[model samples]
Target: MSRIAVIGAGIAGLTVAAELAAAGHAVTVFEKSRGPGGRCATRRSAAGPFDHGAPGFEAVTAAFAEQVQDWQRAGWVGADAAAGASRLIGVPSMNALAQQLASHLPPGASLRVETHVAAIEHGAPAGWRLRLLDGQLNAGHFDAVAVAVPAEQAAALLAPDASLAEAMRVTRSDPCWTVMAAWSDAWAAPGGSWTAPDPTGVLDRVHRDDARTGRVALDGIASRWVLHATPQWSADHLGAAPAEVIAALTAVLAKSLGVHLAPPVHAAAHCWRYAQVPDARGEPCGWNASLQLGACGDAWHGAGDVAGSRPDGVERAWLSARALARQMALSLTPD
Candidate 1:
């Protein structure tokens, strides 16, 4: 079997690793974070818990639906038990989905969290060697490698290789600020997801947790809201202090909602510098065989501009991982 190294334990990386392992190939995932879930993560606070990253996922296409079904069957995700239901979220937190995807990894399949890949070198005879940022060298002759990191980070890591660097350079992503609030009182909206019609609006989308169906807790005593800022707005103010950004966005959210509410009881802001896609070419996934590098993300899929655009993020990552796994499977086959 071929040894494969999947970089970035996000949905894309995890999906690829699972597929490759199921195909009998040895797979290893390296993640820079303390845990999996990447952009689709949840953060816990003294006030409550909020899915600060991806608020929820929608299964549009058959492929995405199948994936969701599998996750649900595996008990990784659950349908929200709220009013007008049309989405799914991870139980307890978003990371549960990633954790479940990784559950069935073969004995040879492994994941290394908090390990940052410093650089990758392709040896003519020895195959691919991945160097960790901590200077701990782990050598393996991988038949293939899939990179699921943001385009900019991927570009930096693959800089030593000209062709791979160029491929990454062409991939770009946008940034945004996610403001999370846990309120003491409940709030109602027309739908589970709301987009401000104002072009110059500070908030792009707002999700009310209590309004979602099948939600674990909607005690009305605690309400969670996520405010996603426009990419341009986030970019312009990314360097500002976190508290200041949160306060400003909280104000904008209050005014936009036509409610003169005070700053949320608990408010926090997270900045995703590479949050969305950037008008890239090709399909939802791309691979460079010569460089043994693959790229994927929502940007590669669509602009993720639809009502249920978050699923595209997982879809793009899975597509890229699947492409690489198939290639590795072929290459690792006995002659």
Candidate 2:
């Protein structure tokens, strides 16, 4: 069995790690965050936890569809009764899916959270070396390394290898500003809305977390809303103060609801520098067989809707990770 390293504990990395482990490879997954869940992200607070990133996603491909069915059976995810019977979300919280996937790894496969792989380098014997954010080299070598970080971040790592660089040459992702609003009582709009499209042009979509199938308030929080600003707005207000972003978006939200909305007891704003790739492209995953280096994530492939449009955030990550894992597993053998 080969020793593999999969970076980023997001859905894509976790998925690839799980697949490689199932293939009998010894895999170690690295994550920078305190736990797994990268934009399947949740922000924990005294009032409650909010899925500040992608609220949920669709299972378009059959492979992904079957996996979703398995996740459903395992209770890692469930159908979003409000969005439709098809839209799927992680149970309990958006990060729960990552947690479950991380736990499903085989005996030799493992996940290391709070560890950041700052850079990747070539090394003999181990084949690859990981330089961590702490400026320390990882303990050993990895026969193969799969990167599943944001495309923007992956560019730096892939730059050392020309073929890998060319594979993701045209990939781009936009920034986003998301706001979370929590209240002790349900959001009091004219008629309660599970979701609302932006009327003020300052936002993209607004959703109520309480309306989703399996969300219960924590502490004093009984109601929650997630507001996502348009890319243009987010870019325009980039690096703006959180309190300012909160005020501006909430005012727009009040206008959309046509109410003199009382302030949320708990509210905050978060900025995602690389949020979505509306036009993600390239091969299913970037691979350099000669280097045994590869990359995958939402920025890779998988766009097979009737209109040829890609599935939203989470599914794209899953698609690319699964494809890359298959490629790596089949080709990997003991030297």
Candidate 3:
């Protein structure tokens, strides 16, 4: 069995770790965050908890459905038919999915969270040595390693290796801004989902009562709402003051709904610097056998082709991870 190190605890990393472990390979996952679910995350407020990262996941493919079924069986996820359309969400929070995937790992399967990988070096034995941000060094012999971070972050990690760095350099990603709020009362929306063909210079998609997960429910009549800003707008206002952005989004939301809604009882803004794949490669996934590094994300595969063109970022990332895992498994024992 190969010793594998999967970088980043996002869906891609989690999926690959599970696949490798299922194949009897020794695998470990390294994440810089405090918990799993890199972008597919949730946040808490006085009102309640809401998924400020990935809104939800869509099960469009047989593979995705099978995984969801497995998750449901494991009690890590729950199925919901929103407006008669099927979707899956984490039981308590979105991160529950990642937590469940991490659960089945072998007793000693290492998951290093809050540990930053500073640099990676190739050893004489063709293994990897990781230099962490805290100056703590961890070296291991691995038959292969997969990098499942954003293209930019991946590029930085592989910079010492010329070819691998070059491959990552070709990959690019964009940013996004998600504005979350809790209203005093449920506001009537025409549909469950609303998209602006031409964003009104502030918001891209407006979702009403979107946080349907059971983890944290909005109290009283107040419900959860979200406004996703266009990538262009997010980029332009990447460093703008948070209060300013919140004010702008609140005003736009009020105008769009044609109601003088109170300033949200709870307001927050999330900036996804590398939110989604802007220019996804035409391949299903990428691997550098020599460097023992692979790169995959929703952007690696055509974003729209993963599930639908509607931009379900988490589901797309999951699809790319699943495909990459299958490929990695095959590579382990080539026929």
RMSD of model 2 against the true structure? 2.2
Best by lDDT: 2
Per-candidate local distance difference test: 0.71, 0.82, 0.72
Write model 3 residue lDDT over 1-335, tens digit each, in one string.
77787888888788778777777778889899998888878787777776776666777666667877878887787764442347677777777788767776664356889878877767767677777898877766667777788878888887756765676678776788888888777666554456754446778876554445465564563677777888888999999887888888878877877778777788898898988776666666776665666766665662335443433456656767766777777767422
After superposing candidate 1, which stretches have Cα over 4 Å from the reference? 80-86, 139-141, 186-191, 197-199, 213-221, 278-280, 302-311
Q: Say which prediction, candidate 1 or candidate 2, comes out ahead on TM-score.
A: 2
Runs in model 2 lying further than 4 Å from the true structure:
185-187, 190-199, 218-222, 303-309
Q: CA lDDT of 71 in candidate 1? A: 77
Higher-scoring candidate on lDDT, 2 or 3: 2
> Each model's TM-score, in the order given?
0.87, 0.93, 0.87
Instruction: Give the residue spans of candidate 3 off by over 4 A.
Output: 106-108, 160-163, 196-199, 209-215, 218-221, 302-312, 330-335
Q: Count the backbone clashes (under 3 Å) in each candidate.
A: 7, 0, 0
Clashing pairs in 2: none
True-structure RMSD, every candidate? 3.6, 2.2, 3.2
